[model samples]
Structures are given as structure tokens and as C-alpha cells.
Target: MKILHLLRLGAFVAADKRLERKEIDLRKLEKEYEEEDDMELEDLDMWDERKPKQGMDTRKLDGRDHITTWSEAKKGQQLGMYVNTVPGLSEVELKNLFDLWQMNMINCCNFELTFLPLEEERMLVLLPDGKHLKDFGTMLRQDKNCLTFVVENTHMLCGGHPEWDPKRPGKNVEAMEKWDQYHKDKKIEDTKKKVEGWKESIPVENKDEL
Candidate 1:
């Protein structure tokens, strides 16, 4: 009993240490996020000539038309990477997790996530380049909790966000359905395998006894 108590205490201490380390990491990431928020990433002096914006007249058009001005988009031409956080994470918690992921991926690729006001759960990651997408994918697999994926074909997104169309399904909506189906199928397959194993484990005489 004494040995068991000592082992339990040791496990608690180890868990506490892990929690402390995670808290410290979060604090550091928060500080970095604050600093990065202040610094706007502008065109570097070393960059060569880029495409100029095509000007168009918009004297009296509806704001809903979307193409209001000739001004360039804030996030230049970058690859749109999407992550569906459909697991009931709050806005703040999701942002902190994304910030932590960004911190983990230092020196690989520089990018930031944009969460739409309407679609808060889906994160729009604007990757500046495609060189590190695979690297990020490898790291993503290590994080069993992270749902990092690119949904294709089933539903469409407008401007890196899902549009609520009465006619068509939204992006992650279809993706989530597919995910559920995948898990359901896997469960059935696993159950079958377990049944086979159990059948093989029974004695040969017992197999006939039923």
C-alpha cells in the first residue's frame, strides 16, 4: 500500500510538471502574439517588381458587390490552407492553439490564420509558399488532436471562408459528414477483426459445442 501511494504521488508530480511547462509555453506564445500583432508585414526593400492592381470605377455600387476598390488585398497572393476545428473549441482557445502551432513551426514557413466573424471554427491559413506544406503535415500527424486538412470537391468556399448557400452545402459541413462516415466504417472493420480474433482464441472443441 505504501509503495502504491508513493507511485501515485510520483505520477501526480510528473503531471504537475508537464502542466507547468505547458503554461510557460503558452505565456511565451501570448507575448509573441502581442508583439507580432503590432508589426505589420510590409513589402521588403529587396523584393522585385510585383503585379500592380487593376483599377476599376466604383462610383455608386453596393458594398455587397465586394469588388469596391482597386487597392490590393492585405494578405498578398498566398496559398489558402484550411483547418476545421469542429470539436467545440471556443474562439479564444482556438486562437491560442493556432498560435502555439505557429510557434512550433518556426523557420519552416511564415504565415498567419484568419478566422471569419461568421465562421469562427474554421481557420484560414494563408501560407506564403508551398515548400513547407508537407513539413507542416508531418507535424500535424504528431498532434492527434489537431484536425488539419484540406477539403476538396464536395463544397466550395468563397474568399477562404464558407458561404451559406441554400442550394449547396458549406465546406466543413460535408467534410464533417465524411469524417463521421470514415470513423463509423473503421469501427465496423475493427469490430470484425476483434470478433475474428476471439473466434480463433476459443478452444477447437468449444467451437463445435456452440
Candidate 2:
């Protein structure tokens, strides 16, 4: 009689498990249906023509715009470049830097370096003005193993003449080789340090204790 009672309890539990699975399946189906409905609504909305929403002219926002115009866009040409004046950077300093960079890159191509994008990698273009910037020059500076030569003298560096000739093949080849070696050496050193660190972090086991 006790065994029969236990069998009845087991049947009830099995029925409950099947019912729970059906509930879960129903929930998943309902969620999928809702997602499909959302996607359809999005597609319909895309067909509707809409204009960009303009920001409301608030006094606080208007004040900042006015300050930017007076500060960065002090000149006629720079007025176009003035998006917003960053904090801490003075208006005059920002304008001067922007004008110098723009004229050096666009007007004169007088940059110390010019970065050209390649299929797999990008190439740096060295222009006259780029030499003045610490980061730009540092990137091109060669180590003992690499060759470093002046592509442009003081005359060309100053943006003295409007027209400048192309870089020499000899200089280009030497610079490229140097940069390649520098990167290779750096990679090898980094790998060695990483291996050393990993070995140090490994726990030492005692055979006697085991």
C-alpha cells in the first residue's frame, strides 16, 4: 500500500515538471512575438520623413555660444572652426594653435609629418611645422640602431617658401628601416618582460609536503 502511495506522488511530480516546461515555452514564444512587432514598427517609422529637432534657445546655452564666438572665432576664417571653447585653454591660445595647425597642414602642407592611410596600416607624413610639436618629432626620432636625418633644414622648417620639393628617396628608405627595427626590438623586449612576470607569479610546490 505504501509503495503504491509513493508511485502516485512520483506521477504527480512528473506531471508538474511537464506543466512547468510548457509555461516556459509559452513565455519564450510570447517574447519572440513582441520583438517581431517592435521591429515591424521601427521599419514603418523609418519610411516617415522627419526634420531634425532644433534645440530650444535657452539663456544659459545662448550665453556659452556667445562666449565661444567672441573667444575662439576672433578672426573671420577661424569663426568656421570654432565649435566650442574648451575649459582651461585660453581662447587666444586655442585659436593660435588651431590656425597654425590648419595653415601648416592645409594651406602649406608644411607639416613636419604627414600620416597617410595604407591598406593594412597608415603611413606618417613628416612636414616642416610638425617638427615643432614634441609628440610628432618624438615619434620619428630614431634610436642608436636607427638612422635619423634632417629631411628639411631651417629654411624649409620655417615655411619660408610656398613651394617645397618632395622628400628624397634615400632619406625615406633610411627612416623606414629605422622605424621598423625600433618596433621589432620593442616587441621582443616586451615579450621577455611578460614571460619573466608570468614565471614569478606561478606558485612553487613542495614535493615533501605532498
Candidate 3:
């Protein structure tokens, strides 16, 4: 029993260290995301080199062949099954980061978080931005999910040699662009519909006059 406990503790420690490293990467990502507008789209420097799997092509993935699997896997992580626990940031904020990292389209779905454990028992806090993060205290009060561990098969995201999928694109600015385009298109479509409605409301001869 003691041996099992020690092994579990060790794994947790390793995971914590990994999370810490990812935090540094996150900061770098944030900086790039902040400055992306000034950058040229053709620049390959925008890609995160760490994404490609071991023994795979060392170059940036300029093609779409490997990106799909990586994208779906990340989406799975963002919308994890059964439970979701975010430490400092609210659940939505963290998931938003994941989505942005993937450069995926905005997925505005109602997240029905079922529970928030005691502060100490909650997940470790990694990224905390008092200025940027929104208050989700109401979510905590309303949450109701059961707490449990989830095992993930991450090998798919970063495939080995013969297999391949680079890491998350780490291009949030690009992702935000997707949202911008979606909203822009929706606005245009809505305006068209509104004009059609107005035309219907007014008589055909009146439409020609005013």
C-alpha cells in the first residue's frame, strides 16, 4: 500500500512539473497571440515547433493532413466528458484557451458543470489573469458533476514517426479571427433577412417610393 501511494504521488509530482512547463509555454503563446495582428500570415514562425511527434518531419506542418486528428483530440480535451474542473480561471475561460490554441471555431454551448469541490481539493491553479478572466462564482454555485479521474490517449495528438499530428497550433489570434468572420457573416445574413422582412412588410409600390 505504501509503495502504491508513493508511485501515485510521484506521478502527481511529474504531472505538476509538466503543467509548470506548459505554463511557461502558455506565456509565450499569449505573447504571440497578443502580437499576431502585426505579423505576416505567410510567416512560418507562427507555428509552434514543439507540436510534431518524435522521428517525424522536423519542419512546420504547412499541410492539413495531420491537423485534423490533433484538432479533434484537443476538442475532446476541452469538452471532457462527465466532469470539468478549472482552478483559478473559470471552466469557460480555460476551455476557451483550449479552443483558441486549436484555432477552432467558437463553440458556444451551455456547460452544465455539476460540482466545485473545496478550494484546496479543487484542481491546481495555473493561469490566473485578474484583468482578463471573468467571474464564474455563479457557475460554482450552480455546478453539479461528480469528481473522478479521466485517462486520455494523447498519443494520437502527437503521433510517432510513421504517424503524425503536430501539437496545438497555439494561434489564438487566428482562432479569434474565426469568431470575427463568423460574426461578420452572421451580421450580413441577418441584415439581408431584415431587408427582406421590411420589403414584405411594405407594399411593393411603397418599397419603390420609400
Candidate 4:
């Protein structure tokens, strides 16, 4: 009878210890949730601060007009290059080329290199300004080794894509609208072409089925 009583006591103690551990875990989870809620509230406040003030000219505040004029003035400041494959050239050689250009030709600001999405062979190089970009183009044109590459001013390629002008304080809403329309029109044209191609591809007998 004494041995049975001791066994019961041991089981009760183990269950009590388990309950205490579960309570501790619950408290820790609640503390974590409280911290997350505090962070979310802080983010909401920051977002509210960015809202435009009532009765204010949003264009003036956003720098739209200023950016438009600045973009026109500094038109070809950035350049985009399409890098074609160079036979027998290693990655180290390509890096050396970029390093050489940065070290010698680029002044005031450095070049920004970005690879095109899904196309590793293509790259876009953002030059410092119009003058430097023109100079770089001239050098590339003269160099026989760079024949495979194609370079053009970004404005030429994108019909003046709206960008933030450092000299301006506001956003370029007008340019942004124009770019949006351009892309919309291009999309419509592309869709029309695809539909026309599909229609032509269908046989006269199969046209009823489609």
C-alpha cells in the first residue's frame, strides 16, 4: 500500500511540472504577438504621415512640373547598353573592361550596371551624364573590339521615361502620364497583332470551331 501511494504522488508531480512549462510557453507567445502589434501600429503611423495635405497643390508639392523641365533639359543623361556575347571572352575580361571604363572615362559619378531580366547576355549601363555618355559612345564606336555591343541613350529607347531629377524637388506627373499612355498604346497594338496572327493561322474550316 505504501509503494502504490508513492507511485501516485510521482505521477501527480510530473503532470504539475508539464502544466507549468505549457503556461510559460503560452506567455512567451503572447509577448511575441504584442511586440508584433506594436510594430504594425508604428508602420501605420508612418504611412499616415505620407498622405497629401488637404487643399494643397499636389503637383507643386510632388515636383511634377520641376521634374518635367529638368528631364527635358538633361535629356540623354543616362545610357542603356545591350551587351552581345563576345567569343573567347571570360567573365574576368568583362569585369576588367567595366573597371577600366570606370577608372579612366567616367567622371563625377560611376557607372551602374544591371543585367536584363531572363537575359544574362544583355546589360544596361547607366552613365553619369549626357556628355560622358556621348564620349563613351564615341570611344565604343571607334573600338573594333566592341562591335558586337549596341549602346543608346535611355531616352531614345524608352521615349523619355520619367525619372526623378536631382535638380528638381517635385514629381513629373505629366511625363509619367505620357509614358503610361505610350505603354498602353503599345500593349494594344501588340494585342491586335497577336489576334491578327491567330486569325490568319486558323484554317477556314476550323474558324467555326474557334
Count clashes in each candidate, considering only residues at least 3 apart in sequence or on different chains.
0, 11, 8, 5
Tens digits of per-residue lDDT for model 2, 1-210? 434544665577688865553434434444455465554443322222332222333432323122222222221111111121223445455445445544544544333333332212112233332213322222223111112223222111111112222232122333445789999999999999987787677666633342
lDDT of the structure predicted as candidate 2? 0.35
User: Highest lDDT: which candidate?
Assistant: 1
Q: Alpha carbon lDDT of residue 178, candidate 1?
A: 81
lDDT string, candidate 3, 1-210, tens digits = 434544665577688855553434445554465455454433323243433322323253334322333333332122221122333456565455334422321232223232333343233221111111111211221232212221231211111112121343222223446779999999999999999998899987798875
Per-residue alpha-carbon lDDT of model 4 for 38-147, expressed as tens digits? 54443332124433323323333223323233333333344455544334546666567556656656362444443342233334555533334434543443343342
Comparison by lDDT, 1 against 4, better one: 1
Error of 2 at 112 (Å): 31
Q: What lDDT is reached at residue 161 by model 3? A: 19
> Candidate 3, clashing residue pairs?
51-167, 113-144, 114-143, 114-144, 114-145, 115-143, 115-144, 115-145
- Ranking of candidates on TM-score, top first: 1, 4, 3, 2
State the displacement of the C-alpha of residue 170, model 1, in Å, after optimal TM-score superposition. 23
Q: Which stretches of candidate 1 lie above 4 Å from their native place? A: 1-77, 107-120, 151-210
RMSD to true structure for each model, in Å: 24.9, 29.2, 20.1, 19.6
Model 1 scores a C-alpha lDDT of 0.49
Which stretches in model 2 have alpha-carbon errors above 4 Å? 1-171, 206-210
